[model samples]
Target: MLIISPQTCTEGFAYDRGSRRCIDEDECRTQPDVCRGDMQCVNQNGGYLCLPRRLYDQPYRSEIPARPEATAQCLLGYTPAEDGSCDDIDECETNSHHCNPTQVCINTAGGYTCSCTEGYWLIGGQCQDIDECRYGYCQQLCANVPGSYSCSCNPGFILNPDSRTCQDVDECEDEPCTHGCFNTYGSFMCNCDEGFELASDGTSCIDLDECSFSEFLCQHRCVNTPGSFSCVCPPGYYVYEDGRSCEDINECDTGNNTCTTAQVCFNFQGGNTCLDALQCHSPYVEVSDNQCMCSAENPACRDKPFTILYRHMDLSSGRSVPADIFQMQATTRYPGAFYIFQIKSGNEGREFYMRQTSNVSATLVLSRPIKGPRELVLDLEMVTVNNVINFRGSSIIRLTVFVSEHPF
Candidate 1:
């Protein structure tokens, strides 16, 4: 065994028992070279060792001096432990990290940080809301929530939980028709009132013509429109008591007359007419103020005297006159004893005469009165040549009569 002298015992040197030789040992305990001035030393079995640690100073060092202690090295996001060892501080759990309130925390190896929640993003260490709607994250529509989001359905739709999508509900399929039903934007509507029905296109309602089908309601024509119906009478007919029926018009009784002058009105079945009373006669004369004026100026005289005939009749009477009583006249002088003869009973019967004779003039005067209204028969015979004679020998005679009726 090699034994070393006590004076040859250098710092951190130890004796090997098996080899009997001195081994080089760590000089951390005896020499200050192992530990910096800020570190403390600890002695080991084979050698005295220096332990790297930090001391609590009243004023902490503004600048960290260079250190040879391995344990005294300051790591990122952590400081040395109070016992001069390195330890990590859970900044995330202790909430010591600066981050937005809406953010979440995550722990790392030596430090902690913040991040956004689900459906959100972290930008510049701050939480930002993500638009899930733009990314088609929702089945129908998506809404962004604070640090989160949700899915919903649009208007006029309902969310289907099984499918997680929106589905449309048909309002018209529910048989909602009172008269008829129409579907619109998320809703439905019924048709009009009882008298109305929905149109073919299903938007508008139109009135039914009850008058057309039932006769007791309307007595005449029925007209139907969008919402109502009307009843009307025929032409030339007026509404009756029912306000819908028609009645015939009496034009004559209503004083609707269409007639000409000098004519008699005769009412017929539907209308009236005007009749000429003297058209059947050869010399037709019109009576005005109970007098008949001759239409022609003169009559042709063949031999001696000429006679003119007149009929006294009512214009409005529909009767006619007899034709056998008109004849020629006989006369000799201008103013002889003028007389009117009347046959009383038979053809050759008693006669009456007048004694007076008036002056000759354009007007002829009857000497005597006739008993009944018969045809006047006159015969005029020429007496001598007179100044009234001409080559043509034409004459016009006008007669005036005054009658007196005596009861027999």
Candidate 2:
């Protein structure tokens, strides 16, 4: 209903004289100085605008303005395929991703994402080694390495099949000790048997040396044996039933003495002796086992001894010196009788001496060491003087001594 001239165009159209019509104007390109600072111009259907420079080139999104049934060209992180379609770019294969060297890159729809590998964590846009020990990865010990971790156990323990737990080691199974062995939670111990002790090396057993600990363990002497001790007794003594004490053995009662038929056997402490049977001399007659008297019918007997006695003794070799061997006592006490005693003979070595203990008693003592396999006959004389009665008499004792060859 209305006719318009070419010169009367609309607000966004321009008059073209050659075509004889109006056309849309490109204000963005024609007006080069339209946009201000930090802004860029965008052309629209009927106008244009100045927008922020950053909003102009958005990645993975359409850069052109929306239009009816129109598609935009490919932006960054995308590739134009041969089928005229846009495809996701594989930055990982092309090594174009910004992920760290220690990180893994995953391809997404339009971009690639960065992630940490095992034993590592993403921190501040970087892959850091994770401390597995802080999380109790191993039961006893833990060690973390690059991109991996390790599990271990402490000493004296072995790792279990799972490689995370530990079990105690049984060291006693190897029999490390000589005598005995004991196993504990994480170690072993060594022990010794009775009458033995553990050595300094902790694996050997040594004798206890029981004899050195106490002297009373044996009655007479102590003999040390391996793993045990024994008691020993001296000669003429035997071990009692208790196995620790000694008892004197009577050689005379056991008929173990070496006395002949002409002698009589007598027993003393630790030894035996033999005495000659009673026999009268030419001027004397036997009265008893140990006494003798002179016959008055013989006139020569008046100057001789009134009586003679005989005795015998046995001694051991290497006997301690100054030993009291015999004691002599008067059979009958007399009033106002002064007595003098002396060794008349058989003391060539001066080994013996007589000590007068009282008016009626005397003792025989040995003063020096005397060895055996020898015999000695001693004549001991006692002279009695009665001062009040004016009478004097003498008696003699013939003593025979046998010394043995051995000490015990």
Candidate 3:
């Protein structure tokens, strides 16, 4: 025998024999008159709703009229209490207000209001974020946050305690520069010491290359140190006390010359030379270390010099014109005597001139500018005449001049 159990259905549901299941009943269609004249029915899965007909026609009304079918009368956002009196509904507590997330909801008598929260403002019926930065809150830099602003400063400045202005940061206190530092309005500057210069990084100091800046700063070579510069001369020279000029070392007087006992050491600008003692030819006698004398009685020395002397001198090139270089004076000054001076030879360039300075002395003057390394041999002759006694004597000096290559 084949038998089937009878199925049971809950309220608002009916058993279907064709599909073998229980289906929900359409209450709105099954009972068209279930609602009142001013109300309509809406079907749900397990129940039905009787809403005002006006709610279907005007869904966005600002004011909702009280329902005549309710036990107590109340406006929108209000509910009836146990005493049958309308009470204010807390839309915020109930989470039923249509306010923005950033707005606050407050309940009133039979209604509710929406307002912007902190850090925001209500504008044109909408909540807007307030720009605190637009109010000039920060002096240097301002960063606008959601509802406020943050104050900042520039690189070399610091924000003040009030957070409205910027103050200069004293980088000098931190010793940012190797030598010195200066603080300005909003920044700091680095400075170097006497002979140093600021580096590219603006925080360090480096040696100033004075030599590279000007070649004439030193006479010979310029040496740069940490904070100073030095003018250096060669092995046989020395620097002037108050300047960068190089002077002759005078190795002969300094006892640094490599000359034998029989040789004489002559010092020049940067070097020394050794020479044999002066040699007197025939008819002449050695009167001094560098002088030779000849007697008037010797016929071979009639036209020749009665006395001959040798002299050596060193000079820097490009000397000033008309400079008094050498002076010749008679050893004995005799009353009523006359003397004359002249350059016998070695004036090919006419670079020298002589002027009588006194009755017994004469001076040799340079007439033109001459550059060297060069050597000039000048034969200067001085003639002395004593007409009262009929005496005439002449002296010759062989002057050898060495001009250095440099002026200093």
Worst window of 10 by summed lDDT in candidate 3: 1-10
lDDT string for model 3 (1-408, tens) is 111122434456566677755566789999869998998686754346676777544423224554555456555556776655567788888888777776677664434566655555555556677665665667989998886568999898988889879988887888877888899887889888888878889988888888888998998899987788899987767889956988788889989888999999988887778979989999999999999999888898888898889999988789888899998988977777899999999999999999999888999999998897899999999988999888888889999998887775
What's the best-to-worst order under TM-score? 3, 2, 1
RMSD of each: 29.1, 19.5, 18.8
| Top candidate (TM-score) | 3
Report RMSD for candidate 3: 18.8
- Report the lDDT tens digits of candidate 2 across residue range 95-138: 99887888798776556667666566555666777666666768
What C-alpha lDDT does candidate 3 achieve relative to the native structure?
Answer: 0.78
Model 1 accuracy (lDDT, Cα): 0.47
TM-score of each: 0.30, 0.62, 0.65
Candidates in order have lDDT scores of 0.47, 0.76, 0.78
**Model 1 Cα lDDT, one tens digit per residue, 1-408:** 224444433344566666655555656644656767766554432344334454332222225553544345555556676555566767887788765787776765455655456555545445566655655656777777765557777775777875357777676687666466767655566777777877775656677776667765655577765556666664434567766665544444565556555754444322344445444223434355322333445452234223333322211111122212223243444433333322212222222222223332222223333443233332222122234442223222222121212101
Candidate 2: C-alpha lDDT: 0.76
> Clashes in each model (backbone N, CA, C under 3 Å)?
11, 0, 0
